[model samples]
Target: MSMKTRTVKVGPVMMGGGWPVSIQTMWKSPLAAFSGPGDPSLLAAADEIRRLAALGCDVLRFAVPDETGADSLGALAAASPIPLVADIHFDWRLALRCMDYPIAKIRVNPGNIGARWKVAEVVAKAKDKGVSLRIGVNAGSLPEDLRGMEDRAAACVAAAEREVAAFEELGFQDVVVSMKMNEPGEVERANRLFAAKYDYPLHLGVTEAGPLIAGIARNTAALVPLLKDGIGATIRVSLSDSMESEVIAGREIVACAGIKKAGVRIVSCPRCGRDSFDTHAFLARWSGRLYALKDTLEVAIMGCVVNGPGEARHADIGITGAGDFVLIFIKGEIARRAPLEEADKAFAEELDRLLG
Candidate 1:
């Protein structure tokens, strides 16, 4: 459970050590078409960013495919409420351009960015601008030198170390490292290997984690253990779902792992034969209202009264289904009962009162 203490500055953000794990989401908009010289795409990105910001994203990343796309940085940085990170694949010039603005961070793998001096130049520019760089290493795009290695974890670690070493050599220590894989087990193993050796901030995520359910499961599998052991600094839930959903899932992961402080965690039991009312629909109906609350709360929605109260004793608020009625419990006390028809509004009103 040894984690490196190396801290990195992502714009004004300081990650690693005791820093809370941040939730980040990527933009789905066209990187190439999102901007222009004077007609900056910042305003366009603003609308999308507002949505993501409302979902509580800690950082937002957009791909800088080319130079024209880089112009969007100013508007995004100017109007964006959260830190902005530029994702650069091979172009060192785009990396430089990203550093030119108040960009918070850059995701670039020195191993693939080409030429030693180019890497140094980018690193130097980032250092000069006081911008943090995330040395992103992915299993899908491992270095050719490590292509034949039977152990992907070793290769992943080597790749990360190579970039970290390069950044360290440039007298720049503001670096966060990630070793991402589609397989949860591989991602965990590689991160485990890295955590054992270095103290640099580790960004945890499962790359290309499929559609919603599978992606959440995979990300949960990889993160739970590391998080419990105090291993991760920032996290991203990469799913083929909406960016807001991904951000929500990321926050949930942190909450479930007990690494983050968020409002209102609703613990609902899986409906079984004994459940009364429609537990599934009841939960689905009230979940959004709970999500809308400004303050964080720990809530439980149980299927039946049999074990509902006992199981929900730890939650700040609880609800148990009984026939066509729902018993709303606050702090383990039965507060009121509402019919199935009025359950949604009733719960929303109660939660609003509870939050207020």
Candidate 2:
């Protein structure tokens, strides 16, 4: 099927156009991270976001829960080097306040924010202020009217439709929709249903998806199909981990699905009998060194030479273990062989060279 296309403007960023799904992370800094509500933690968050941007994160979101947090927006926006999305809930005034800032996007569940006019006001403000709006619908936080429904997906889909309809009615086409469920299948089905019904840009995520490893796997399983089907415009790997980890995981997910052209791709065997090295230890070392290459290089870390180089010949750089030493392959040819002890450093140096 030819994917239905929709374009949305978020601050200065334009999403959709079959744009490679952008990676996003919500900043978890407590108010303590700021001196107070309006206190500018711009430097602190910007520092973290700089690392994220270097790691190839396309968008960063911060929770604007109160007046103080809302006030921080302008400073953060002025200082931030990357696009920023403001997450607002509970108060329409907060969203209204966010409109005054230089945020690239605003994410709010239309259900919780009071009245139809309130939503219209928010949408209008975003439209007037040139900031994009994300109508985020979550299963865990479904409207009270939708609670205890016989079918939760139906309830979520209905809620999402209503929200989308609101935006459509407002003549606000610069909108993206998200229906997040904790379960992988639920999110998968919900987005599928939404994609079939609506032409709006979609932001896909499985909310509250647990800690690091589990969360990444669940987000991947849910997002991969929809993404491959040309269903989503942006993606967020919502890990209960650090923002850096979330960006890394999101990039990896898109890369693994063969959708994202940038970012590192490390392919190591799950450690079978043919393996001769400490596969687990090797991956640990490799993952750290990977930070330097970060979002720019794709390296395959394979356990055995048998299927290693051939399976990963497409990779920019890769390594295959041969008895005591690992052969480092750049593109398809063997560049050099390094002993296990120096493999991580060698890989890092080689990756830097490749990126240069």
Give one clash count per candidate, in the order shown.
6, 2
Best by TM-score: 1
Query: What are the per-residue Cα lDDT tens digits for candidate 1 across 38-152?
Result: 4455566676787677667779888888887676764567677788999888888889987878889989966568787988888889778888888999877877897678788
lDDT of 1 at 262: 59
TM-scores, all candidates, are 0.88, 0.86
Those runs of model 2 whose alpha carbons end farther than 4 Å from true positions after fitting are 31-41, 272-276, 288-297, 304-315
Task: Kindly give the stretch of ten consecutive residues in candidate 2 with the minimal lDDT sum.
Answer: 30-39
RMSD of 1: 2.9
Model 2 clashes, total count: 2
